[model samples]
Target: MSVHSWPTQSLRIRTMFASKAAEPALWRLLSIVTLLIIALWWLSAPRDLFSAPLSVTEIAREAILLSGVWAYVLLTLAIVVVMRWRWIERPLGGLDRCYRLHKWAGIATGAVVLLHCVLEWLPGGLARARSQPSADASRQLGLDWNAATQEMAELANGTMLCALIAIALLRSIPYRWFRKTHRLSALLYLATTWHALLLLPPQLRFTPLGALIGLSALFGCAAAVVSVTGGVGRRRRVRGTITGLEAHNGILEVECTLAARGLPHRPGQFAYVCFDPAEGPHPFTIAGADPGARKIRFVIKALGDYTGQLANRLAEGQQVTIEGPYGGFDFRGTAREQVWVAGGIGLTPFLARLEYLRWLGRRSPSVTFFYCTRNAATDPYVSRLRTLCTQTGVTLALVDSARQRPLDFDAIAAGLRDPSGAELWFCGPARFGATLQRAWRTTGLPGRRFHREWFEMR
Candidate 1:
């Protein structure tokens, strides 16, 4: 027992460990740490490093102004590159992770960059910098202007614009335009790196710490390029087609079948499907299907920009490109008692799960389902699932929020044979899952009993 006199069960902990989307959070945290280290170093030093006299505040401010703007922009561009690089997103589970890391890294970098601008940049210093004695010692203590410095500064400013554009299109932005502009940012990162290296005077060029940072940026750029070129060891392509399209409950349902490339998949995993080469492919969960079969299918509901068009535009036998089958929702790796939570179209992955179970001719080994939706009017695959539960003896509890309903958590728990050992699976919107998570935790289910899936949402 680590706390509260409750025994710590790693099984539940392990079971509960699901994938997380990396947002722009981590880069911010790292940036804060850098500030702290700078402060401590400044306080302990006998003399300032800048050669000329400048207070800690002024020095910090100037540092921010110089690094703050470009770091965020460059990092954002790098993120675009990384996202573009993950062609083998599904089998290796790289695409999802890449998006997350890039997001978090950008967020982190974005924050730090802003702070560097705010907390560190000396306000309106262009004039003051010009007034400094030209004859003063060639000490690199203050902001200096030169061809190299000017070029780097311009590149940094350009990259910032690139990042802003990237963020704007994070969700609703058309995929093609975003992809092309993001590549420009990648080239800018490379440009900045070269610019930085060239400007480094003999004194700081090869310093161990400086070299390390440079190396990291270099490697990141290379990795980004490789991923884009299928050079980073990602599968070059996933060819598939729209096997069928049907409208269910006023939402369009799309069925896609892929020719297996011996790509490994697990229950709760998803694939990116394309109806037109010009239109960006979207990630849709695999409806329960046979992995061994030459073809596997996905069920998608008309939801947004790409998806809303699915029902009307894509036809049977259209050639499509798929980018992934990425996710950490695989249930086969565990042996814990299971509880699956689904919301709206979130149940698509479980369809595949049930199919897999059927193929093996085995019961889902102690499973319970708690599905939430707006109302029965929009439940995408109710008919198929009802038949499935009846045949498999899988117990289902439906919660419709549109009816102003609260999920019967206690009642659901009451039926669980081993609530403490049950592995809970959840997939839905951010707020819905978070609310359910808190409720489940309050009810004393093991932490592992709640697993949430991360999908792309604006």
Candidate 2:
């Protein structure tokens, strides 16, 4: 209910449209999917699909086959992405990016599945209009092997798949509702897997393309089982109790004492914290931690509907489930100097890094932190950040929007003694990060040197 908390649903919509630097992981995933599609299309599609003239019936048959291939590939990949396996997550640039990829894959699957269904209908509609004897599209297209039964089964499964996907992608839907309904997708995947196994052309059934699909289905089904059984991230989860909770400005600083074992987390990683089982877990950055001590802290801004209620629902001594120690935003680089830019709640990770550096007693790579906030006097973290910077020998700049112009490339570049040599680490609103990233790219800094968190995962 706090005015400062960003609405979660609106933020999710903004994240979908907000521009940022292209993720290498996303490009790599798309490339893999494209290559697989081409391989499958070449192996299974009629050799004369593009070479020779084709009739409407033949075209419809080919379109249906091609669209089915795309749906299978994307939907399978989407299932695998949600397994939350660390090895897979690390290659995909963290679990957040994996979820982003999952969302896109689901959208693409819905589209291709829709196309497949339409193609299935086209030939039947055309034949009926022309007064042909065949009422079944599969029979007219020479795809009939118990055609009526197959078509009904496909229609039932495809309709369910599309409905589930629509529920997932619509930002207007509540996340709790989405979470509950989205699990049905695994069951839907199993249904589609069965449909594919039964309907695939006999000629291509034993080919390499079929092998690829078979493997995708196997992995997807396994991931689906892991998800349905609530085993995803089970290995990483640990039980903990809330030891302290304090409200600063509109943010909550939650402290926890791990009851099981120490969660060895890097400076800038985050965790999926489940305060209430009914609400599920939400990701929060590890604001501070000591590897040896069974203690951790999270600075949370009530930016969404679920998060807004956390302050009231949580209390000291409350049992909670903590899964992770995920993310790759740790401020490690080879630059002689580091420029850190944090906007509002984005300061959490930087605060963690500063605390870590203070513990290490080393400030070899000089750092200047630009902390962006609305008001210096009202923002509680400003004083704590100043003290940490002093302890760690980091220079701190408070970029108060109320008193000064917005922080821009010029202001950041002016602070750096060598813009080209210094690596920039940023976390903030997606649009702000995109703006800064676009400006930074012009400086000829290698893209890898500019690090930021892709924190949105709706």
Candidate 3:
């Protein structure tokens, strides 16, 4: 539709979706962290870092401090993101992307911790064997604290943190175990926070770097507490009952009617649906819902262990906890033409948008929706999508991968009247979107012109 008004509580949908790229917020956050690290290094870095003939022990010590500080900051940041705070999630574009940020931050923290551990002991071991001064000599420069005892404790903590991160990164691990083990990071983070504060140089405790550390620890601890106490996303959660359940091919269509006024959500947004408490909440896009309506729909594909069993486990009238209405994939753009690509179950967001358009009786300038599926005959959505496209005045391009060639960037480009002037919105497999986005940008489309939602939670 031509910039139709959508209801939202905190931010105007029109304004929120006007932005072309979701990654600016992510990049800006990273830049801020980098600058903070640089500023802190300048404030309290060792003289040996700049002096000539820097010893291996000196370099190792410096690496230890730098990596530790980075790990601390990133660990805190990961906790803050996992809190599912709407304000933090909004700028990042969606909760799914926020989880993506969390995933990367955790991995980075793990890598930094590993680096810190290697630098902590490797140089000392070599120094001892070579008859050189022990690495402990560098500790005397500053950051005065218990040396041997704290070092042992830190190594233990670092090892454990690394282990947890490993378990998290391993997708083969059952999601239930992953969920439970992931909570343990909150405790580990608390330990790291304590270690950071306790060992910070006495003179620099009140400096800007210290303040950043302190504020981060404070916020991080708060978020960690929420996570530990099982209070994450509690305020945003609303009760709902399953009103309908259907299966089409391998997809599970879950329809729910809220017990209260529905949580405010924009079209193309998603929520964390808790169908089974034991398994916890998993994110599912709100495939169809009116703003503030009690009724909503989620189209889930059987892609994993937990979701594969949902069709059998879920039933009508069963209560559920929905913690979301998160994401900024609102179908808004500033181009002469808007192109949509949905791969299989990735059609959820676009389906929501089409329904919204039909309900509003609005039509945009020029819109093309490409629904890519294996077979159109067995795909239940094709018939309804065809009707919605007709009602909304949007062109539908069905790409049956089984019958014909796959939908590629060139195919999409061929349909566009002005490739440079059109915006592309894609929600599909990560590899598919990556290939399309690479080609789109290679052809001179601005990076901001392509809006895509990341589907990976881990």
Candidate 4:
């Protein structure tokens, strides 16, 4: 029987098995959060639950309240993670994974909060509507100041819910507008925290659950303050000047020399570069790093509004701020051979790795680099890449999709000295990576050996 035709094994099961090995870091994060949620729910459970029977509404209301608290905790944790703290990034696998978790937590928080709001209104909506005083009677009686304040707070909470849902669901919104609107969440979070503190049952306030909520709220507020003050990347940020700028086709190569201490970075890590204050910071992979010279290079494609305008607006000696040296795409582990697949701008990280290998001045592992480009003849970096590959003893395989077929696993694996033992490192479009990954599975390659850098932040 063929290896792909395992008896009684369904494709779904096979896919799950493969994913389990490939995404251990993500699984670890999910496991930790799941356990925490379960523990919190258990702790928050009422002691007299079985002693006295409660109505379905009572039970559901309690569940919704607990879920809301859990969601808030997760949201606070997500906020803390996004602060780009080095200590947190290391354990969480990388900054990319950290951001992935942040996005998931934000989405989960919005969903749970929405559910909580719906449940709160379900039991009382009709009764409240019928009992509300008439407009004339309300005017005659005058508004109750305390009730008015509570109503206003509720309105604010609802507004925040709508914003969170929109932020999570809408992807077409411009990043600048998205970022500016996202900052308002912190203020809304503060308001929600205040509301919870004032309204939660007094008996529950002294419990461990209450303490946890209080701490989370305090931490979230602190993070919000840091965010508002433009201190998100303050610790890691360094002033630099554009030492060189090179334009190739639609791509731009930028070199910066640091005014402060240089960031110690691994070969395949990335950094957030801020060239213009109005443009805001954008993440770019570090294509080269020279600690001695305090210089770093970035290869950026004209893919968006900020990057598109860079070639025209940027000039030598322009002051810039760089914050990071993030990501964990480094090739530190041992493998019999390495197969690197880079698609277009994804070649940035591999360029840095090749440079590092060249500096080593020793024959490294058997490396086959597949650079998939539109047209090899017109590729500006073709000669430069070939020179670097020669220096590092790497075999460069240029796949020109315009002339030939797209890259497939069979072609990539054919160059590998030991297909099973080789580690496959890919940096490219998500769909391209997914396709390659599926192909790898058909060949029964261990998913753990396939490493990919997820490039999309949104």
Candidate 5:
């Protein structure tokens, strides 16, 4: 796919697979169910001061005994927990995934806040709190304003949720707008946290003592917002400059190094790099990094539009922006044998991975590199890769499509020590990787042993 459509389309498929949208739907359905439950509670609970009708006091009576409100809270917690796994702990290597998941969790949490307000305001609920002896400490301290405080709380919370939804949906909105408005959400969450605590009696502050049930939800939100916004996520940028450029056939490759401390990345992770503000901070994996020497390297091939002009117009040190080191397409988590497949510049991160292995002194694992190109003439890194593989005990397969020759995988495996148990890692066009995966499955190996990273998404 073209770069312009890459992130959006890639994310759509991933989001679908993750079923993050399910959380919002779950919350919405629960909201309707919660309303029904509250209605039931109102019908059953004592209504009068004598009969509280649906006023704040009667609603408070049911709110205290509301069954399964905690279930919706549990649902929200599940989303946050799932997201924390995929984004924070897993080696996803990119922020797009995190951002998407973060949005999902935010919406779910916001929905729960909404339900909390509505459930409590039904007749006997807030009315009871309002009716509590006016001479109580809260009233003595000017806390007699339950009506105004509840509405203020709702306004703050609802507006923050709307801003988050806007940021998540209409991503064409400026990043600065997203950043500023979304920041308000954490502060609003803090406010809502205090609002909940202040309104509830000490005895009802939690479903169970010290669990701080409702309080914990708001805290989780505040923490996530701080983590992402305060540079704990991939919020920092490292500078880089183009040092060399060359065009071979229709392929354009540019060589560059990190101009500063460089970014921390694994062998196969990519960065969302932007040379201009108008375009995307497109993903391009780290093809090479001199970890001990302190510089980042990447090789980009011309795919059209802006890339065609890369060789001629990109000056050395033109100052590029980056949001980085994302994607789980690395072998750090695995120990199996590896088969790395590449199409054109998809070979970028693999080369760096090999270099990293060499520097770290681990005997590089047995590897098979599959290089595909129209011909040897158009392959940008084939010579360098072949030389590196030969030096590092890696088997290299160069597939030239024009020759119309069948690649004898059985024959290729004969040269390898063993093919089974060896992991296959593929990066390149989606179709190319998928095709290779099918072929690998025929080898009678566990499917998980074969891995593919869709570098084309960059």
Candidate 6:
């Protein structure tokens, strides 16, 4: 069926349903489970929760404790998901999407933790000010190691807030410091676990809420152990040495030959690379892979401090560690005709796909590749791509954004022989992809037919 044949209402309905289906199933499941747990916890609580009048301080205290429980659960789940990304990558769509979820979970956890602290402390502060006579007796009664545990928990909470704020706001912080601070969260999490164990309301000890919290604590403990032992991505890590380096306008291509054991990866997947222990692991798409030669290549753009310094600091024989081959942006199981839109550095995955098609030595699919950049003349990879496209019989159009208007669905549809049957793949800035997706909506295209890779980790 042609796209033009669909009625407007039908198209709208189809798009609505497709968009709903496109939401990550794993994320939806996690969200539903979390909400269910929260509801159960509230329902299973004592009758006084809803039947009796409660003071503001008592209500706030309950809220603070509940929020802390939720935050710890989410934080632990985020750590487990991120550390074992491969397990969720396929179901979650891609590692990029998984990381995006991981980031959201982390931020949400931090915000809730902050809220818990404020709610717990504000009432105490006001109460102390209103009644100084009882403060001394209260202090005397609260003293001892349990009080110390509460203080330690508060200290850990403050440290976590500081670290999260620093990492979020200051990109220029030394990578080593960033990594250490990030890992320190695990230790702080352990401290909070202790606090929760000893200080949780005595009434909840025999209830389901307590069991759920205990399970979450166990999960968090296990994740912390894996993190502290550096067990993340252990199996995926492969030793390799840089064999060649090529610099292109603001991009650098590093070619590396791996050890005898190959790092199996599909086209359009990326890996986290660690060149220096201090610099930590940074993700880059695999531009090309040669299984026979046991070699893989990465196209890195000088967009940040660590990447900008790579060209200058990297040597030919420098050893590196690679951990992945993650992402599910592969163009398989789609329509025979595919439209691929790549923006600037976004071209890396397409290049990998093209290389894979060439290696397969079969007739290429009907693909229209629109490569968008500032200038086709100066883009170092354009010439290489042109040659590869010609040899592989893939249609290539270089769209110089400086000289031409941005690409729209109409422009893309002009080249498609069967718009309804063609899948659209996009990798670029999130805003650009959204623009094209909106355009696709008006063209009566199924939203599922549009595949986009979101590269933003933050």
Cα lDDT listed for each candidate = 0.57, 0.78, 0.77, 0.77, 0.57, 0.77
Q: Candidate 4, residues 193-289: lDDT per residue as tens digits?
A: 7656554555566677778888888888888888878788788899999999999799999999999789899999999999878758889999998
Residue-level error in angstroms, candidate 2, position 188: 1.2
lDDT of 4 at 130: 19
True-structure RMSD, every candidate: 9.5, 4.5, 9.1, 8.2, 8.7, 8.8
Which number leads on TM-score?
A: 2
**What TM-score against the true fold does each predicted structure earn?**
0.73, 0.87, 0.86, 0.85, 0.57, 0.83
100-186 per-residue lDDT for model 2 (tens digits) = 788777777777777776766664553222212222434757765445545655765576566655564455666776777778778
Ranking by lDDT: 2, 3, 6, 4, 1, 5
How far off is residue 3 in model 4, in Å?
A: 48
Greater TM-score among 1 and 2 belongs to: 2
Q: Candidate 3 residues 1-458, lDDT tens each? A: 12332232113223222222344556577668867886887776545558687677666655666677788898888779868787788777777778767866776677777776666667345322221222343356664345543665576566666665555434556777778887877877777777787666565566667787899999999998998999987888999999999997889999999997777778888888998888888889989974465788899999977899999999899999998777778877788899999998899999999999999999754999999998888889999999999999999999998899999998899999988789999998766776787788778889878888876666
RMSD of 4: 8.2
Q: What residue pairs clash in candidate 2, if any at all?
A: none
Task: Supply candidate 6's per-residue lDDT for 340.
Answer: 93
Residue 3 local lDDT, model 5: 73
Runs with alpha carbons beyond 4 Å of true place in candidate 4: 1-28, 31-35, 124-157, 438-448
Off by over 4 Å in 2: 1-15, 18-21, 44-52, 123-169
Tell me the lDDT of candidate 2.
0.78
Per candidate, the number of residue pairs that clash is: 17, 0, 0, 0, 31, 0
Candidate 2 vs candidate 3, lDDT winner = 2
